[model samples]
Target: MTRFDAATADGRRELFADAIRAHDERDSAFLTIEAAGNGANAGNDAGSGSESTPWVQFADGTLNLDCTDDELDRLKSLLDEFPSFTVDDLTTPEDVDGTNVRVVARTDDERVGEFVDRVFQRVYNRPDGYRAWVTVV
Candidate 1:
């Protein structure tokens, strides 16, 4: 678990930004905070027939799929102005196989590490501290 303490807002913001950047690099995707309905969902198709086969589909939820590195850094800085920051108690596995990984970002240290692990699992199928069949991804 990585640990870091922030005594001021600026320090917290910087730490948060650094954490976000690290996460982006590991995940190969950027993070952004956009409006709820301004994003597109990558849907999955369940049939090879025509559009009248009652294809089962579902919304994958909204996300900022096109966030720039600088944008993500800015958001991290903004988030630091809240209260405290820490990124500890994070675990990363060595292998992943397409499963749901849970990211628990409580303090600055834990949040950053967990966020990075989760994003990496989501985008690049990487594993964090402990590998599991259900949360490997």
Candidate 2:
């Protein structure tokens, strides 16, 4: 399982932002979060369609979210802090959104390597890691 290393929603969000920002070259960026909310379930059931996936498309500077402006504003505010961490050695995730959010980093305009490639490589080669995925009905 791509471990929920972070405990709370904000923690996860911070982790996500950190992942994107660490590779972020420009000051501005777009954030994308793939989420499947369970209708009125209150997280009582543990299956599909009850998780959220967020991504920061630094290349395009856009945030993929299915929420309101208020939500976006809050996220933007959080990003303004801009925390940093190491993604190269994450416990290796089984997937990104459903498997792994592949993050590639370029050097001087040339593709050097994936920033968070380890997450996939470790699992891709060994096929054993932690990842949480729930398909919405």
Candidate 3:
């Protein structure tokens, strides 16, 4: 996990910006994060279509998406739709396989959690190193 202080906005911006830039040069990139707490149902019942449980807490830091070309494109689409995120392409050329975009977080931590939960879901009792294993739902 690339260490970025998720507690601060500047850190998040730098992390996202750097990730976007790094994605330009590499075939894959993943932000690694440490586990912070137990994954518990946050009052949202099963089949509700909305999960209250957070796979990676703010305190748990952030994990890398380990994105592929297609996944990065899909992520860009998701970021475009998400109000709290922006796909910045001013500094970089268009991505070869995807759009050259930087997914910057424009909102607070709580909202970031909500956005991530939309893409990655947590499985209880499954640990990946110090973190609970997360999968696309």
Deviating ranges (above 4 Å) for candidate 2: 1-7, 25-32, 39-58, 65-137
Each model's number of backbone clashes? 18, 21, 5
User: On residues 1-137, what C-alpha lDDT tens digit does candidate 1 reach at each position?
Assistant: 04232323344334444545554455634332111111121122212224211110001111122223443344345335423333222223346322222222344434443333333233332222212111100
The C-alpha local distance difference test score for the whole of candidate 3 amounts to: 0.38
Candidate 2: lDDT over CA atoms? 0.30
Q: Ten consecutive residues with minimal summed lDDT in candidate 2?
A: 109-118
| Top-TM-score structure, candidate number | 3
Q: List the residue pairs that clash in candidate 3.
A: 1-32, 30-64, 31-63, 31-64, 95-100
RMSD (Å) per prediction? 17.5, 15.0, 12.7
Q: What is the per-residue lDDT of model 3 for residues 1-137, given as tens digits with 9 covering 90 to 100?
A: 35432323344334434443343345343433222233342222222234222232221223333333564656656666676666443233355332233345666545665455443423222222222222221
Q: What is the lDDT of residue 123 in candidate 3?
A: 25
Error of 2 at 78 (Å): 13
* Model 2 lDDT at residue 56: 26
Candidates ranked by lDDT, best first? 3, 2, 1
Residue 22 error, candidate 2, Å: 4.1
